[model samples]
Target: MFFRALLLLLILLCSNCENQKGETSPILQGLLALDYLILSDPDRSSVYFSTTRSASVEIAYEDGAEPNTGNFAVAPTTSVWSVTESNLINAFADRGYTVNVTVPTDLSSMSEFPDQGRSTWTINQLLALVPKYKAEDSNFQSAKFFVVFVKGSLAENSGVIAVTVSGAFGIGAPTVFVFKEIINHFQDNLSPDKVRKAEQMTVTHELGHALGLVNTGIPLSSDHQDTAHGNHCTNTSCGMYWALGDDRVDSFSPGTNPLIFGSECITDIRDYTP
Candidate 1:
């Protein structure tokens, strides 16, 4: 298994995390707190229901859905990501986790330079960018988990689809990164809705990691973890599948309508809050 105890040491350092109830919440202790790097942040990398849910998510999309300077034009709009935003909220809501999710109605934009930032960005670099973005709109200070959708590529060199540094130690902002370049890769072959499905699935999957599934933040209900693939589900078709591939994401398949959580994963979350 790639998920070694020593690797855990390298991925997560939650020094600033505190248990609101004197003990770490299941999500905080096991799942959400993991700090490993993926090809796509949380895509490579939800909300709903109940006020008691401790963590909330806010999704920030670049204003106007900037088209890449590269060949991948026709960026997915904020509405595209909003489909993901709603999907995420309902994913948690069904589990009774009480997570609240928000996406910007007035997304931030960068018309000055269509290529707003580098093709590849490091966590620290993205960190610096988030607050600067918030400076344009201070609402960021309120979100517990902030995901930024920018019109660029990340980990293009590593085959990583995206990146997130949420729950890492010494970090003040808990965040996730999504790149538009990924959308471009699919736009050529998949229908617009299918492409959007891939985008939404990535959003919810990463948030699942942040919510503590498959022994990351919350304890497991069964032995469903694909240890071979780190913290992903054993079922490749499942949303929480550990290793993601360009061609294999189940949500992208036509008629896979009403993207839903896998049964075993929901059992795990239920065990945590029940």
Candidate 2:
């Protein structure tokens, strides 16, 4: 296996030696993509949910979804990354894993989703892009997770805030998608801070799914899984609650912590051995 990987690396370097710097050859891209297929596992959550080694979460935003301080002028405290990264670190720290989440500034050098020129996306479309983008990550093998923020909605008006796909999806890389279009629709008549927190809540919630919350992959410590909703906690206060909330968006209130796992969910994570 070691020699095989070394040969592939040599091929990548030699194949691109005369091409433009930072651009991978078609053959190299195909080789890197094979890594994704080989990494596919039946147990999607265990690799991320209970890994003893430190893990990395890489984030990318589409052209429209790029993070900007300008959004703060329209809605105070609208920093998407600050809130999201903080909540992720806090949650994973509780589970005894050191998680590092990053939003790369240099996305032009990486593989990107093709310009489909649509306002909404389907899982199939995004799944096809996984191996391509996943191949670009330098830390692809170290318990890594991929997240992409796009300015669109899920297909057929699914009305979901976000979605998570595990190895079961056959993509190998576990991925989380946050739809800025759906999140923006909820900002009407509400403070940006509230909307900001709600968006953060959604990101963490889907990531919870990636971590195998409620009995998806990590077994339950108690009977709190809302089986009706498929891997959500029954507790209303929990971020993992199914359907999240209505269009008005009132799940988060002042002085209430919306970025959290319910106690039951935490118990399951902490008790997980693998």
Worst 10 residues of 2 by lDDT: 67-76
- Across 1-274, the per-residue lDDT of candidate 2 in tens digits comes to 3434675787768676837667777776776666555454523555555543445566666667643222233334444444455555655666544656553333453234544566878888766656656643323235566777777788956577788875433345568877877776754665655566566677778777776776766788889888888878899877778865644245454233434677888878778776
- What is candidate 1's lDDT per residue for 10-60, written digit by digit as tens? 334442355234765554455444543321122111121222343345555
Which parts of model 2 are misplaced by more than 4 Å? 1-43, 67-82, 94-115, 135-141, 169-171, 246-258
Model 1 — TM-score against the truth?
0.60
Give candidate 2's TM-score: 0.68
lDDT of each: 0.52, 0.62
Question: How many pairs of residues in model 2 come into backbone collision?
Answer: 0
